[model samples]
Target: MRVRKIQLKTFKRFDDLTIDLGDEPRKIIVMVGPNGCGKSSVFDAFEEKQKDFRPWGGEDASFYSKAFFYTDETKKASTYNRNNSILIEFYPPNAQSSRKTFYIRTAYRFTSKLNVQTLSAMASIFETRDEPLSSIALDGRLDANYKRLLSASYSAFEAGDKTGNQVRAELIGSINVILEKILDIKISSLGNIMDRKGEFYFEKGNATNFPYSNLSAGEKEVVDIILDIIIKKNDYDNTVFCIDEPELHLNTSVQKKLLIEIEKLIPENCQLWVATHSIGFMKAAQDELKEKVQVLDFSEKDYFTGSHTITPIRTTRKNWQRIFKTALEDLTGLLSPRKIIYCEGRDQPRRDGTERGFDANVLNGIFSEKYPDVLFVSSGGNTELDQRSEIAISILSKVFDGLDILVLKDRDMASGKNTTAHDRDVYLKNNPSNHRVFVRWEIENYLFDKEVLKKYCNLNALTFDEASYDGFVVDIENQNIKDETGRIKNYCGIVSSINAEKFKQELAKVITPEMTVFAELESCIF
Candidate 1:
């Protein structure tokens, strides 16, 4: 079974919200937005729905209690009608069967404790043998429950119960896999004495028997969540696992790795819903699950209403990578560059044997004093630059105001006086004023000016005759050095035995307003 849709009406902090999880089992739904934008509120709505939910063949309660309600407590004497409700639709795995719909209307209460009566109802629902389905909600209090359940399971396993032993074995195996892959440590054994608490002993090569309690807080948090899922795996089919703030107490790296690991623990029929503030987790999930993941941005602006809107940012399977890249860029402040210059290559040595600095560094070195607001970013390659331009433009247009974005490409092997004219026409028609291309074959070719080369050799105290250098340049041009990148490397090998990067730096220093490429760059930026 899978959640097909959820509709919230007058719910806490939500006037009207609908989330559509596509009709597919094993889907991962990710909720993202700024604080107070109703990310957690969506999870709360789901939890509310789960409280009184029963399977298809289960008995219904005559009376259901509501704890939380939407109300204005400050206006006690005033009259207002408040009806808060959540409606969720679920589709059974069988294709021929119709979808199952469930809903609940309740008051809004801000409390951490679970309702005892509701818990009893949930217990009864799970106890029913026919069509047993389970739901697990995880928040901040995972560590305490993790320890209690883990210790009890280990004790039962020690008592020689087959079921307890199976649970212990499964938990240990899963935990060890996570530890090894994420932390590079193996679990040699799970240790326990007659009256002593159980602990995990980690092994690394010759190093063995490190206690579980010795793990860092972040590691412990990861283990806790994974263990909680493992312990609860047997109780549910078509399960719904809701995790709010899964990144709690974890660093960026752990946040990413833990989410990837958690995905493995989810059963094939189970659906996972995550509410996260960490871009790291979002990015990691996107990479791991790809199109199986759905991200809803609750903070999107509704231009028609002139207020922030709650909706899933529509994306296709092919475009999800681009969407997440833009989101991650926004989260990390990469979009803060007022004037973004898209270019090829990242931190490769220039033709003049300069130290490794990609287009961004080269442009920065030359243009920073003139245009401090401009930020040059390497797109890793020319093709990537072209493919990602639309996504970058779309995301930047929404988040940035008065921003100037441009793309700079190399002429490559294509012949044209205006090297970037075709690309500008094809890709930059919307912002033609901001796009540019190097006059020469590539940025490396532009750095090979005779005057610049002569000056660079002299400054570095390298022995090179100006007449010989002029002859070498003429020969290279005569040979039609299309691969300027290779030619630069070869030129550096002949000119200086020292680092080629230093020569590129010297060339960058000598670059002046007279260079045609520099003039074009200046025009593109302004």
Candidate 2:
């Protein structure tokens, strides 16, 4: 079962938002927006809805009535209705069971504070059957739950109830997997409570143990999240998980890995929803979940009707790409490279036999060993490289003080009959310091040098004359390779069975230090 849709009217920042979550068994719904735009409010709305579905038994009120109770009063005057409400519908895999819908109007804070009341409440909730744990987990009140779990495990251990031991073992195993993958730390065992608090013991490569308290704040945060999930794993299946600001206290890499690990821990037939402000986390989520993830943007606005509305921008892949790209651009402080080089290529082979990274590899192969400070970014193709160069230079210039930026495009554009070497030279000269055109027809053409090809073919470079070079080009052209980029790749395969990347590496090693390309690059950099 998974959340099929959510409708909110006058609920906090959401004035009248209706989101349709497709009928997928499992999905990752990512709520993203600026501060106060209602990303967290999404989680708030979910918690409110969950409250109405009391497993312990509660008055069954109309869904609309429950939702209307939670409406934002500030908009009551402008909106036609004063009652605020939210509607949530779920899709169950089993058609025999009746459809479940929830209406909610109450909101509760998911805090992280560890207190006796919180512990007792979580303990009671955990022991209850079919009780949703998302409310507890989302509230940042997992510390109490963690303590209660440890206490229960201890009680079970003393009572010789192997069930408790089994649960602890599973939790420990899961935690270890997450820690090793995210933080590179492994827990040998979870230590018993000492001084009213339990701690995790880390196992060293040499078998020594250390206290979990010794872990950094970031490490503890990761551990806390993993522990929370493990403790509540039994309660998570077929439920909606709403996590607000999950990136808190974690670095970009950790934030990404944590979300991935959490997704893996979630049971099949369940949905994971996250509201976040971190672009790093969003990008990571997109990378990890791909098409399974939906990203919604929240922006606050005042309608001409004098009603305040928190609008949710349509969720689309292109929208997310633009959002992430813009976010990364704004976070220039995180950029590490002092110098930026934009080139036209990607590492993957294109239909044209040229890998999208061919140009990047060529540049990196030659310049990286000597100049490790420069960062080369591939722009996908020659035209894209040219287009992105100005944008990249303009953006990077503002971010990095006195940043050195260079854009390189293949000479392919000027290779046809109408364009001359002078035209290319003039273009290069006009852009002088930051722009350059390949001296050869293309980067691949340079790789087709007789010496490089001979090395792969196990033939002497001296054996390859101008006629051999012409014949090789003719052979490539005659093959009628579909992708222009793939032509060199196809030619290389025919001449030598060596892998393209390896061939490039070998060719790079053989390049003379005094090569014209090297001289040109040096002039541009220096």
Candidate 3:
């Protein structure tokens, strides 16, 4: 199914806002936000627009309005917390006519009442309905006036030991299939899908001794994931998949594989949505779907009201053409294990102490100005890994398939120890270095003796250097400090000129103008 637009009025935090999703067919829609920004509210609001109209579980027709709209108009509080008129116009796939589903959760003027009444489950079609659809087929079909419940209808509870429709061995069978596909796990059969509310073996397979009560938390979550996928894929064309942290209890590999399956398996007639905080996991998933994917940044104004505007950040075709190659090469560079001449610091600051050097503010500086496709980021140090991951993933997901990231970390010049191996492994989840330098170190560290340093650990040179690149090698000198804090009181000597120049040169190889645009994504979290 596809949505035309969504209008929120007096929803929880929004006073009045409308979002025009435009005409897009069966495409995945990713909405990201900090916690409590009403991203889930958007999904919940969509549930209210279903044909059965029992999403909120209230008996009275007006009950949904009051509960889902802003509570007090004077205070500008709308129901569902987003507080904007929440309306969605949806068109089901395989439809011959221009039939659609529209839901509005806004206050309507009451002729006799003093206050306006909130409206929800306000679905309408272009052709007009003489009476609201009363009964729907539970076998997974809907009449014309009623649209299927996208979010509410799909849920996979923990496997309870039961054999009937509520919980069954079928769930375990399904889970085994997924585990086999993702984690390469294999077994004759698995424990049953249980009714967790009672914590009993609601369904037991004849071959199994007992239920999944003994299964590990990770295994249970594996079942949870498999069940959620099956339910969401039930009526693939009509399902509105709302997965909350599908990465829950999953390792990076499983997370990436599951995301890949969902992207490939979900029918093209339906849209898929996921909310997650895993940067590395997302990087892997984005790579799997690089050629066919779209991401929308909902980081701005999670709630909208009067003139409620959502800043659209769509990863488009232009974005792919712009940043894909550079990101890949950067990632490949990091995977290389040689003497990575990390260039850093000022290129002799201009009169303003910003124009000429490695000023991060200047998008067209060393990295971006120098590299068109490669992505080199000024991480400053190890503290920026999380923020850098987020920025890097968002940008690279738009351009390439995998994370194209190169983080230049400073290993004390005097000590001669390499931090590239340790730091790169922390983010990439795999040791990326065989030696101190990388395979692609030459691409960025041309001015510095990166090739020579890998062989000799003795040079780091850049613009305005007093000595050759050989003077800056980290390990050749074997200076000081791998203490508990890994610090040298006189770090003045380690943060020398040779290493700084190498840092800048490495940055100059990757970050391009397009990748720099991601720097302006208006991050709400670091």
TM-score for each of the candidates: 0.48, 0.51, 0.44
Q: Which parts of model 1 have CA positions greater than 4 angstroms off?
A: 22-26, 53-84, 92-171, 185-189, 198-211, 302-311, 315-526
- List, residue by residue over 272-362, the lDDT tens digit for candidate 3: 6665544434454345554444444455443544465653343432233222322243343332211111223342446773434242332
True lDDT of residue 484, candidate 3: 10
User: How many pairs collide in each candidate, listed in order?
Assistant: 12, 23, 66
lDDT of 2 at 15: 46
- Model 1 lDDT tens row, 459-511: 66654456544565674222344334344544444543545455565577666
Ranking by lDDT: 2, 1, 3
Error of 1 at 98 (Å): 16
Q: After superposition, how far is residue 133 of candidate 3 from its true place, in Å?
A: 19
Supply candidate 2's per-residue lDDT for 21: 56
Which of the two, 1 or 2, has more lDDT? 2
Total clashes for model 2: 23
Which lDDT values do the candidates have, in the order given?
Answer: 0.55, 0.57, 0.39
User: Looking at model 3, which ten-residue stretch has the lowest summed lDDT?
Assistant: 105-114
Better of 1 and 3 by lDDT: 1
Tell me the lDDT of model 1 at 423. 52
lDDT tens readout by residue for model 2, 386-488:
6777787778688778678777766566434434457777887776567876555555555555555555555333333445446646633113222343444
Largest lDDT belongs to which candidate?
Answer: 2
